[model samples]
Target: MKAIVHVGLKPGVLDPQGKAVADTLGRMGYDEVHSARIGKVIELDLEGVAKDKADARVKEMCEKLLANTVIESYRYELVD
Candidate 1:
């Protein structure tokens, strides 16, 4: 099975990296670039797990280590 995890900062959290990129874009004449947010993607391959079990395990992984629940949110998808 293939799993994809998307991790992003929660709303109201400060994103300095994102802000810096936005500032640079404006400096480069990309004034149209209003706001930007930085996030990450994690892909995993697993074996011996059924689809339902995989979903539950992946969610646990995100909660325990994949994301900082205080400032970040994460969601994952399981694929064949």
Candidate 2:
């Protein structure tokens, strides 16, 4: 099975990196742009794991190590 994770800052959290990008975009003749947010993607390849079991395992991975649950949230998709 293959697992793909998308990690990003949760609402109400300050994102300096995202803010900077937004500011730059506004100054670059793109004033219509209001905001920009940054995120990450992680892909994992696993063997012997059934698709039915991948969601729980992948969620565990995110909560334990893949994502900073304190300030970020994550979602995962599994593919066979």
Candidate 3:
């Protein structure tokens, strides 16, 4: 099984990297882009997790280490 995790700053949090990208885009003639947000994707391979338990396990992983829950939010998808 494979777990794909998407982690990003919460809406109220500041994102310097995203802001930089947006500024660069505007300077490069991408006037359509008003803003941008930076995020991370994490892929994990599992060997023995049951389908029913996958969600809980992945959630735990995010809460424990994958994401900084205080300022970051995360969502994940599991695939076989």
Best by TM-score: 1
lDDT for model 1 comes to: 0.96
Model 2 lDDT tens row, 1-80: 78999999999899999999999998898998899889999999989888878888899999999999999999999977
lDDT of 3 by residue, 7-78 (tens): 999998999999999999999999999999999999999888797798899999999999999999999999
Which regions of candidate 1 fall more than 4 Å away from where they truly are? none
The lDDT, on a scale of 0 to 1, for candidate 3 is: 0.96
lDDT of each: 0.96, 0.92, 0.96
Candidate 2's C-alpha runs over 4 A off are none
Candidate 3 Cα outliers beyond 4 Å, as residue runs: none
Of models 1 and 2, which has the larger lDDT? 1
In order of appearance, the predictions have TM-scores of 0.95, 0.88, 0.91
Q: Clash number for every model?
A: 0, 0, 0
RMSD in Å for model 1:
0.8
Residue pair clashes in candidate 1: none
